[model samples]
Each structure stands twice: as structure tokens, then as C-alpha cells.
Target: MRRLQSPRRTYDWGSREEIPDFLGQPVDGERVAEVWLGTHALAPSLVDGPDGPRSLLEVSGELPFMLKILAADRPLSLQVHPDAELARAGFDAEEASGTPLDAPHRVFKDPHPKPEMVLALTTFDTLVGFRPTAEILRVLGALPTSLTQKLAERLRAEPGFAGIVALVEQLVTDPPTPQEVGDVVAACADGVQRRTDVKRAYLTALEVNEHHAGDVGVVISLLLNRLTLQPGEAAYLATGIIHAHLKGMCLEVMVSSDNVLRAGLTSKHLDPQGLVRCVSGGMSRLARVEPEQFGESTDVFSPGLREFALSMTQVSPAEPAGTPLPDQGRRIIVCTGGEVELVNEHDERLPLRRGSAVYADAADGTIRAHGTGEVGQAYTPTAEDRATPLTDLV
Candidate 1:
């Protein structure tokens, strides 16, 4: 069993305490954004060897999926990821154009569709997809701002998904002025004090304003569905789902690609055309995934995605059967909470604690668990996921 060493990433919007305390580390006020646990070329996790610490890419090659612990204190960008077809075309075009992979303007990191799922470890707030047309009009009608009235008029004239897409196009092409943005925020704040049925919508706008005061995304919030995932609840986004995560911590799992098309509320490179391209998929509903109980102690969270699924198990002194994890593909187990001993198919046992993890090759077969506390197992498509182009599979 190879004990994997994961990398912790820091970003400005990250929480100061969530990740540190989760790993039992003393809080130092460092903003820990994400803990990457995968074999992706960029920020690959490592494992120790007699020679030295080796990249997981060298040890296990590239896994189909990546797992991460995300802790956010502020709103992230309103963004979308390209589908498998778009990812390949976009990446190839960028590559042919002689754009460096590490360049700030580079978009696609890998030729894989980035369909992601976030399982909340804390109360998580997010703006996902588009709200219903009727709902959007009702919320906008309450606001007396010119921006809101114009948006409401357009939505009423067209209605439904077409109106939503048109509104997105208008916002991206002709972004709201700072004064117009401020007016919408002020209207939403005032509405929050008076409106009851539409209070949640007003609050969502205000919440985005609290983080990004003058960004055009504050008005864009009116277009999305505000969703809150309680602890242990999960949300999944297939390719082309537009979203922005606001506040709280989560366990994020996705294809081993870092491709993102951001439009606003971020300091990262902006790509309005890329965002609109991704959003043109025409999705109407928010995607929510429920965990399926597997065996006695394990819960499998797979939205039937071909790339990867996550299995979480808890074992204590009370029940001695431990966790029997399924093999979806290449297996990597991380002890997110408490202490546990992992027994691989070869009968090798590795003891893992709060922040420790292990990786197993396809030849290793199934890995079982023992001891106490919680463990998360990642299941990808054996060894084929990374080696093959996702375009062929999807």
C-alpha cells in the first residue's frame, strides 16, 4: 500500500480554519482553499519511496478523476466547464496556437470534460443553473431598478430558457455599469427587508453583493437558482452547468481536468465568450445526486458518471465488519476523519489518520478497511480512464 501525500492549495477566498481544523492542524490564519488528491499533471499528489518522494503520475500514472477538499469563505466566479467535445476542440486549438500550458490566458488544462460533484461537509451555498422564468420575473418585478425592470421585461417578452440565454448574452456583451450594478444590489437589499415569498431571492443577490459589491455577477445572481446543501448532502453538475459557489466547505470530485471559463467575481482570467459557449448547453434544472448505501457501512455517491464515484464509510469499535469498498477503477482511499487501517487486496495493511491517504493500482484489485472513523474511497475506470481520450468514451 502506497501512502499518498496530498497537496494543500491556498486562495484568497478560502476559509482560515475549516481545512486546518479538519486535518487537526493548529489554525495559523492561512487561507486553505483546496487539498488536491489525484495524479493530475498540475499539482499532482506524491507518495514516498526509498529513492525519494515520487509524483503520483509516476507511481500510478494519471487517474480518471480528482478529489478535493474545498473551503470557501467568499463567492467564487460565475463559471462553466466545456463538455468533452468542447474540451478537446478548445484544448487542441489552444495547443496549435502555441499557447503555453502555464500561461495565464490558457483555459483548458487537460482534454477531459470537467463534470463535478460537491458533497457538503458544512452548510454549502451555491448559485446553480437558471431559475424558472416565472420565478425570475417575480423576483425582478419586486425590484424597481432600471436593470431589474429591463431584465424583467426581456424575460416576460420571451419567457423560459430562451429568455435566460438571451439575458446571459446581453449581460456578457453589454455588462452592467457600476451604478446599475449598485442599484440592483440596493434594490435587492431593500426588498429583503420587506418581501417574504421572494426573500430568498433577495438574500441571494445581497449575499453575492456582500462579497463582490460592484461586479455584474450580482445582477446575474437573479438568473440562477440559489441552493443550499446541508452537511452530507450532495450536488452534481454535468458538463455545461453554470454555477458559482458561495461560502462553506465541501468534498469536490471531478474528472481530472482543471478547465474553467470564468466571467465575473474572480481575479482569475476572464473568458466571457468561453463562458457563454459552455452555458449554451441549455440546461433547465439543477442536478442533485443522492448517495446510495453500499454494504453495511459504506455510502456510494455516483451520479452514474463514467469518470469517477466516491464511497464514504465510517467504522467504529461498535461494528467490527469495517468498510468493504467497491472497485470502480483505480482506487485511492483517504482518511478524512479519525483513524483507519486499510487492507489492500494483497493483504498489505497501512494505517491512516486524519490527513493520510493511500493509492492502489488496478492490479491491486479491491481494498478493504478496518479500525475506526471515516474514510473516502475514489473509484475511477481501472487504468483506462486517463490513457484514453474522454471523447471516445463519452
Candidate 2:
């Protein structure tokens, strides 16, 4: 097992202090978005080695999965990720067209699909998938404007996921005018001010408008499902599912790829057509992940994805015994709370405190934690298990 120094990323939508606070470090007044914990060329974690610190990629070739500590103070972009096939195709096409990898408009950074899950460390708010047709109509009816009315009419005519896709395509492909966006925002704000039981759709729209002023995502927010996950709760988003994480901190694990097809709610490059192609034409409800508890405080979060799975174990002062770490695949363990010591089969140990992370090679054999703390472990799943369709998982 090797101690790792993870890379911190700062973004405009990041929380200024949450990540630093989690790491037990002084806040630098900069927005710390994510602390990347694996070997992806973009921001690889450094592993403490016998010869000094070295890139994780040098120690363990490219990992199939990447883990992260994501802290989003503001809303993220309304975006979708492509599936494995689409990712490979898009990456090859972009390469063939000679689009520089560093170009702002480059969509695919790697050829792997990204299917991620967020385990809430705090109350997390996010928008995912499409709302049911009836709920969407109700929200539209409350607005009663030309843009919304037109979308509502189209949805009413099609009345399923197709309608939702059409509505999104229309909004992204041929966006509403600034005047139209302003009208919708005004209507939503008025509704929030007047209604005793304000609809979450309108509230979300008003909130998104505050940050992204006249962006079309303000209106698109109404079409997606709004979810609030309490601490310990998790939600899995498969490839092609449109989503925007709105608030709070979470531990995100996914296939090692950075390809994103964004539509709106961001200052980054927008690819309306690409986003349209990546979106799944099926409607889905909130993808809440139910953890399987073992012994007392160990919660295993497996979204049936062969690429990755996460297990969080909480140890108390009364019971100081640490749980045994997985012995097969390469694993990364992060201490989320308190302090602990990771002991390997040879009795060698590494001290870990809150926000401390370590990388364990498969050859390290059985490892155990010792102390009172909470640790999250990310590892690759066995290849023998048949893959579960993302549609069924959602």
C-alpha cells in the first residue's frame, strides 16, 4: 500500500471551503471543485514510493476506473456522457478530423464511457433524467408562455420519452430568444413568490436563472427530475442520462474518462448536436442507490457496473477494529472522517486521517484498517459477473 497525494481541481462552480475543510487544510479562498484520486492523464494522483513520489500511472498502468471527491457549491452543466460504443466512435472521429486534444471544443478526452455514481456526504441536490409526462405538463401549464406552451404541446402530442427528447432538442438546437428566456424566468419567479406550495420545477428554474441568467438550461430544468439525497444516500447515472448536479459534496466514481456532451448551464463549450445524439430516448426516475450493509457500519454501493464499486465503512470508538480491505483488484481507500491506520499482511502500516487517501496494489494481499473513522474504498469489480443493462439499473 502506498500513500497518495491527490490532485485538487478548482472550478468556477466549486465550493470555496468545503474541500479544504474536508481535507483538514486551511481554506485558500479558491473554489476547490474536485480532488482526483486516480491515474488519468489530465490530473494523475502521485503515489509515495520508495524512490520518492511518482505518478500513479507509473506504478499501476492506466486504471480502468477513477475516483473523485466532488464538491459542487453551484450547479454543474446540463450534460450527458456517451456509452462505450459512442465514446469510441466519437473519439476516433475527432482524432480523424485532426481536432487537437487540448482544443476547447474537443468533446472526447478518452475512448472510454463514463458511468458515474455520487454518494452524498451531505444533503445533495441534483437534476436527472426526464420528469414524467403529466408532471411536465403541469409545470408547463403553470408557466403558460409561448415557449413552454409549444414544448407542452409537442410533449402532449408524443407523450413519452420521444417527446422529452424532442423538447430538449428544440430548446438546444434552436434556443429561445433572450426575451423568451427572460419571460420564462419572470414567470417562474412570479410563481415562486405567489404559490404557497411552490413547485420544485419553478424553484429550480428560478435558482438556475440566478446563476446562468438567460441560459436555456433555466427552462430545461423543468423537464428533468429534481432529487435531494441525504447523507449516505447515493445516485447512479449511466451513460446517456442527462444530469446536472446542483449542490453539496459527494464521492464520485466512474470509468476513467472525461468526455462530456454539454448543452447548457456552463461557460464551457456547448455541443447541441452531440448532446442530442448522446441522450437516451427513454425516461427514467431518480436512480437512487441502495447500499447493502454488512456487519455493522460497512455499506457497499454496487451499481452493477463491472468497472467500479464503492464501499464505505464507519468505525466507532467502542469498536476499534478496522474492516478488511478487498484483496483482489487494485483499490483506493479514502478516509472521509477521523483517523485510521491501514495495516497490510506483512504488518506494515500507513497512518491515515480525514481526507487521506492511499493506493493498494493487488499484490498487497489482505489489508485491514485500525482506529475510529469512516473510509470509502473504490475498486474494480470482477469480470466474471455478467454486465447489467444500464436501463434496468436505472
Candidate 3:
């Protein structure tokens, strides 16, 4: 096991102080959004052990997945991710077709699907999946003018996810004129002025659109489920589930890929067609995750994913030397909230604390944990792919 250092990603929507303060570190007031702990090329973690900061890629020879503490001060872009096949195809096509990898408009970054899970470190708000037709219709009924009438008519005539898909297809492929857009905005603004409940949805819809002026994803928000996750709660995002993290901090674990196919709401690449192609075409409902309590010190946060599993544990000062590491696949552990003393097989204790992580290879076997405060682990399982190892982590 080796202690590692994570890389922080500074984005515009990030908080200027949240992450800095969370890690008990000082910053120059730069907006820091995410601190990535895995190897995903864009920001690969380096070994920060007794030696120095050595890139994980150079040391381990493979990037499992990048872990992050995502701090969102504003809404993230309305984005979709490609499944494995599509991701591979798109990345290869871009490469073979002579598109620069770092180009501003590049969409697919790698040939792997991005399935992610977010565990709230604070109260996290997000918009995920599509709202049912009836719910959307009710929201639209409160809007002003013939716009509401037209939408209501559509919901009445053609409801369900299919109908929403049709509407989205139309808006994306054959968008309305600029005049039409301006008119809709005006009507929404008017509705808000009239103290209509629809105004809240409309304003949210409009805010998301600011990132993607012409994308249909702007209006799509009006038809999606809005959710707020308290600290320790989690939400899993599969490929093509349109989602935008609105605010708050969270621990995010995802597959080892960066193949985002965006429809709008970002300065990054916009691949509307690719997004539509990869869309799961199902309504998204609140699937809030509750951690499975493990004794007194451990709570496991496991999203049903094949590639990765995360466990959150709070070690009290009185707890004894904990269980040994699993005799399974590769395991990566990170301590974000407090200090931990890890003992190897031969009883060599290594001290670790916040912002510190370690990679335990399959060959090394299980290590014992004896310390105080919170720690999380992300690892690949050796057993069947269908079963999540969060239940099995001792």
C-alpha cells in the first residue's frame, strides 16, 4: 500500500472556498470544483508516499478510475455519457478522422463508458432523469399563453417517456426559431411575475440553458425530476441519463472513462446527435442511496456498478485494529476527513490523513485499519461483475 496525492480540477462552477476549507488547506480563492484521485489522463493521481509525487500511470501501469470530491457552486452542464461501444467508436473516429484530442469541440475523450455514483458530503441538489408526463403537464398548466396550451396538448395527446423523447427529438433536430425562443422566455418571465409555481421550473430551465443557448436540454429540465441529497446519501448515474449537479459537495466515483456526449449547457464539446443516440430513453426517478451500516465505524456506499465500489467509514478513537484488506482485486483507499493508520501484513503501520490515498495491489492482500475519522475506498472486485462488493467489504 502506498499513499498518494490527488489532483484538483478548477472549473468555473466550482466553489472558491468549499474544497479548500473541506481539506483544511488554504487557497488563493480560486474556484476549485473537483479533486480527482484516480488516473483518467486529464488528472492522474501521483504517489505521495515517503518517496515523492510519482504519477500512478507510471507506477501502476493502469488507470482504474478517477475518484473526486466534486464541489459545485452552480449547476453543471446538462450532459450525457456514451456507453462503452459508442465511446470506443467515437474516440477512435475522432482520432482516425484527424480531430485533435484537446480540441475545444472534442466530445469523446476515451473508449469507455462513464457510469458514476455521487455520495453527498453536503446537501447536494441535482436534476436527474425525466419527470412523468402527468407531472410535466401539471407544471406546464401553470405557464402562460399558448405555449402551455401547446405543451399540455402534446402531453394529453402523447404522454410518457416516448412523448418526451419525441418532443426532445424535435427540439434538438428541428429547433424553433430565435423569435420562438424569445417568446417562450418572455412567457416564462411573465408567468414568474404572476407568482405562478410553473415559474420556478421555468427559471430553472432557463438557468440551465444559459450554458447551452439553443439546446433542447434547457426545456428538458422542466420535465425532469429534481432531487436533493443530504450528506451520506448517494445517487447513481448510468450512461445517457441526463443530469446536472446543481450545488454542494460530494464524493464521486465513476468508471474509468471521460466519454461525455453533451447536448448542451457546457463550453465543452456538444454532440447532440451522439447524445440522442446514447440516451437511455427512460424517465429518471429519485434513486437516493443509503449507506449500509457496518458495525460502528463503517458505512458502505455502493452503487450497483461492475467496475468500482466505494465504502465510507468513520473511525472512532476507541475502535480496535480493523479488518484486513480483501484477498480480492485491486483496492484504492482515500482518507478525506481524518487521519488513519494502515498496517500491512507484516504490521508496518503507515500514517495517512485527509487528501491522502493509497493503492493496494491484488498481490499485497488485506491491510488493517486502526485510526480516527472518515475514510473511503474504491476498488475493483475479483468475483462476478453483477454483484457489487460493497456488501462484501469487511
Q: Write the per-residue lDDT of candidate 1 for residues 166-225, one digit (tens) a residue.
A: 898799778999899999888887887776537387888888888888898888888888
Give lDDT tens digits, candidate 3, residues 226-322.
7778887777787878777888999898898777776655666676777778878467633555565546666666566657767777766575667
Candidate numbers sorted by TM-score from highest down: 2, 1, 3
Q: How many backbone clashes does candidate 1 have?
A: 2
Quantify all predictions' global Cα lDDT against the true fold: 0.81, 0.86, 0.72
TM-score: which is higher, 2 or 3? 2
**Least well predicted 10-residue stretch by lDDT in candidate 1:** 385-394
* Per-candidate clash tally: 2, 0, 3
In model 1, where do residues sit more than 4 Å from their true spots?
197-199, 281-283, 381-394
Best of the candidates, TM-score? 2
In order of appearance, the predictions have TM-scores of: 0.93, 0.95, 0.87
List all candidate RMSDs to the true structure: 4.2, 2.2, 4.0
Error of 2 at 374 (Å): 0.3
Return the clash pairs for model 2, or none.
none
